[model samples]
Target: MILAVLLIAVQVAAQDPRLDRLDPDTRAQVTAVVDSARLAGLPAEPLIQRALEGATKGAPGPRIVTAVRRLSVDLGTARAALGDGASVPELEAGVAALRAGATPQVLANLHSVRRPPLTMALSVLADLVASGVPADSAAVAVLALAPKARDADLVEFRRAVERDIALGAPPAAATSIRVNAGADVLNAAGPPPPGPALPRRP
Candidate 1:
């Protein structure tokens, strides 16, 4: 009876199609994470579940591997906090929320805030940084004011760009300001100087 049960368990494990779906690199990373978790006296099953949940939720496979790697570093802490009963989807949700700026205290409150489209938010934030706003400042400003921003709020954000430029802030700083504001605001504020025009050929 014991031999038959062991054979069935092995067959079930081998039949999981998702294990075969992972690319070679991702499989290696996942295996490494699972091994580390086992060594840490944590069950490997939860980590595997988290990876599968992330995959089902449309997170890239590389990101799933990265998340598991991070989890492996503190497997004991994770297990203590999350409990052995936590499902893979719950772990993925918690990690994603944390990365999105939810603190441990505020993490439970996340259900109240309507999440903005991540792609658009990232694009806008990146543009702000590229425009000359300091990355730290730009990130803060956008997060604080994004919900309240009107067309005119964008105008004010632009004014900050002009102020930064006039103050002789570096090009990178200026880019950050533009990111917090908007490109149209910068255009209206007037363009920054052109790089030295082609030297006249005598």
Candidate 2:
């Protein structure tokens, strides 16, 4: 009986206390969504965090629940594109990529062209798209660099794009010019690393 009590205490303690800030009904709803996501082998913290962010922003309860539900779906979609080997940050970044207008095929193709730990590349892709670069152009630019650009290179590339846009260049034109300049040598570094690594043939 004592052991059972301790186990129950452990389980209660394991729950995130910040969730208590939510109304009981909203808390239960969000918890159900998070639990479902957890069972599906996806990260749950992001969903909880999304809920908390909504609550903090003074969003309506229904809105918070809807956002969490949508994010859960987005995470699953990202996982399918990135595969099981992807880290939580990579998956979250993939969610950002999708939200920023990148297609699932682009995400999957990124998985094929790049090695694991795709967080930086995914982040830059999302940033470019969100900054108004056309999604196809953003994906093209990112895929061009993913082969040989280091994390630092991606950061610099994003900054350069931002600068050009700030200087009145069209987003797509900026992305295209920068990619050609930065990736010319890297693209010639030999084709993508071996193996069939994605969801589609293309």
Candidate 3:
């Protein structure tokens, strides 16, 4: 009986319930803040610690609450935008942009281009997909913006588009682009012909 009691004591001690000490409304706010930090790719433990410290240091509850509330709202927006498939960096970027007040249209436009050397494209696409954009729309938009894209960008974009379509970018969108997208983009963006194929080999 003593051993069981000791074990129960240890388990109870292990559970840190600092937030539970706060009023219900304040606890909700604190949760929102911490969750927001997580969504924004920020470390929540530190933020929560900081808030706790501030509270200890005589900071007004309202101020700490407000700060946490703001952070929470920003995180909520970002997480909503990102859906369920975003990576850390993508979440960070999307959250930052959302915090900075970027619109969905702007995000859509930005998603279409693969940055130089093509290295940035895959990550960008992965993030966009996570953030609730349709795979077909995202792929098509990215390809459309490939004229100014780098070679690496094209390679990665092709890979991502294929992956998305295979996983399902919608039959209609997939068909529209697969049949003609690559050819058209290549024709437009590819280097000029070698002087009409050297006059058809005489």
Candidate 4:
């Protein structure tokens, strides 16, 4: 019994070292939130990381708590969109995509393509939207290129679009040009190559 108790204590302490920095009440609140997320089978690590990020940035206790709670909700939404089998990284990317106006249907469709490591594609989609591209246009553009483009290709595409946008091109036009360019490359190569490595998540 004593050994079991010590093991439990160690487990709890290992959950979040940053929790030690929080005041007692705030720590308790955050711990409760983390426990609830774990119980729900959601990835609680992101929430813990978010809280730690906030704390490191010198945010107040309430704000840190709020950020963690919000991330939990986002993770839940992402899981619902991506289905039960979604990895934590997939869910994280999905949340960012959702926040940038990608509908759950869009997310589902993206996942249906059977591509792994969609983190960069989803992030590029979000970045496009955040850069003033219409969400629908961004989705269309991303979906068209993602199935064929490698991670390096996606990075180049994003950079091209950004450059075009900086040069006074409309977001839609810039995205279209880059996506079409990718298509051109694919057509020139003939037959798709093997899939690229999984995306690296932030």
Better of 1 and 2 by TM-score: 2
CA shift at 125, candidate 4, in angstroms?
Answer: 1.1
Worst 10 residues of 2 by lDDT: 5-14
State the lDDT at 126 in candidate 1: 44
Top lDDT hit = 2
Order of candidates by TM-score, top first? 2, 4, 3, 1
The candidate, 2 or 4, that scores higher on lDDT is 2
lDDT of each: 0.52, 0.86, 0.52, 0.80
Cα displacement (angstroms), candidate 1, residue 36, comes to 1.1
TM-score per candidate, chains pooled = 0.32, 0.85, 0.35, 0.82
Weakest ten-residue segment in model 1 by summed lDDT: 108-117
For residues 72-98, could you state the per-residue lDDT of candidate 3 as single tens digits?
A: 565455445444444445545555554
Q: How does model 4 fare in lDDT?
A: 0.80
The alpha-carbon lDDT assigned to residue 41 of candidate 4 equals 69
Better of 1 and 4 by TM-score: 4
Q: Please give, for residues 128-155, the per-residue lDDT of candidate 1 as tens digits.
A: 5555555555455555444434435544
Residue 86 CA displacement from its true place in model 4, Å: 3.0
**Model 3: which ten-residue window has the lowest total lDDT?**
193-202
Each candidate's clash count: 12, 0, 3, 0
